[model samples]
Target: MYERTARESMCKFCKYVIKIYGNQYLRKPNLNDIQQLYEVHESKHGFPEMLGSLYCMHWEWFNCPTAWRGQYLRGDHRHPTVALEVVASQDLWIWHVYFGVACSNNNLNVLEQSPLFNDIESGVAPDYSFEIDGVKYKYGYYLVDGIYH
Candidate 1:
């Protein structure tokens, strides 16, 4: 009952947020927005055509069901957990987020299962123009650790 109530409240809150700020803050960035982001990112971080930084965080799932306990456990974390992956700009605006992956899955698994990454990889990615070391490229960069394969 508590879980159901909490889930309903959270859904309502999310709907409220989307209704109030979705157009300007929650929606996907357009090509012009991406260009502006790249400019700001470059001037601050010195990385050309950078869209954002990617990171994954794990949240302990104290009430995880018994059947899924093993699926959510990793060797490093004694308890079950859920993983959340996010890409955020320097200003802390979250450009993308994928949540609810079992902690047993690493960043690579999370990314591979992410619909956003699939969409981006399917050619909807922005054509960010930049040159590095005298070589030109058309892809925007998202800074991530070597955890991804």
Candidate 2:
């Protein structure tokens, strides 16, 4: 069927892309990256220790399995869909990406399921400290819309 063939082609293309550019484009930020990110975001937004902007997008899953349709259906759309959560800098450099979440869920739900703060919780995150209006802060923050909790 056309669906099966399309799925296979997409999978193959994704594999090839990941094989070629995965490490450079998809990995988490290191210490140096964190420092630069903080500096750039702080200078532009007046928010010290800021990382980037957070947003979520929905992708219609036209090939979603019938059995899982109910779980992925968005209230606004009749089609089954999946969600992708991304955090990117002003330069459009993606720092974090979490995908495959059901579109039925809200941005907050996707965020809760994402491993965005795993390193922070495990105490392995890079050390970030900055002063905002003479107040010292140790953790980095992200610019998120009102939808986020």
Candidate 3:
């Protein structure tokens, strides 16, 4: 069936992407990357314990399967959509990206299911610390749009 072919093709593409750029771009930040981002964001942006900005966007799924069309629909969007979430730096380095699964069929749903926090929960996330004014903080925070609020 068309669904099976499409699914297989997507899986192949994902594997190719991981093989090509996963090690350099998809991996978490290193000690130096952490240090520089922390310092610049603190001094320049006044966000002392900042990591990066997190955003989620919806992409219209015009070719969505007939059975799943209703699942991805929203009140505002006339068509079904899938979500793409990214965490990026001011310098435009995409620190994180999550997409593909139909389970995350909207921005808000994507946020809930996103693996962005998995590294931290698994205790393998890079360790970084920063002070704001005079108070020392343990964890970094992202600058998110009001939709997340």
Better of 2 and 3 by lDDT: 2
lDDT, candidate 2, 52-117, per-residue tens: 888888988899999999999978987898998888997999888889577878987777677876
Q: By lDDT, is 1 or 2 better?
A: 1
Model 2 misses residue 48 by how many Å?
A: 1.8
Candidate with the greatest TM-score versus the true structure:
1
In what order do the candidates fall by lDDT, top score first? 1, 2, 3
Ranking by TM-score: 1, 2, 3
Where does model 1 exceed 4 Å of error? Answer: 1-9, 128-131, 134-149
TM-scores of the candidates in the order shown:
0.77, 0.72, 0.67
Q: Highest lDDT among the candidates is held by which one? A: 1
The residue ranges of model 3 lying beyond 4 angstroms of the native Cα positions read 1-20, 100-109, 128-149
Residue-by-residue lDDT tens digits, candidate 3, 1-149: 69999999999999999999988877878888888988888898987657789987777888988999877777778888778888898888888888745633555556657787666557677754555665454444432352211
For candidate 2, list the clashing residue pairs, or say none.
none
Query: Against the correct fold, how does model 1 do in TM-score?
Result: 0.77
Error of 1 at 98 (Å): 0.7
Candidate 2 versus the native: TM-score?
0.72
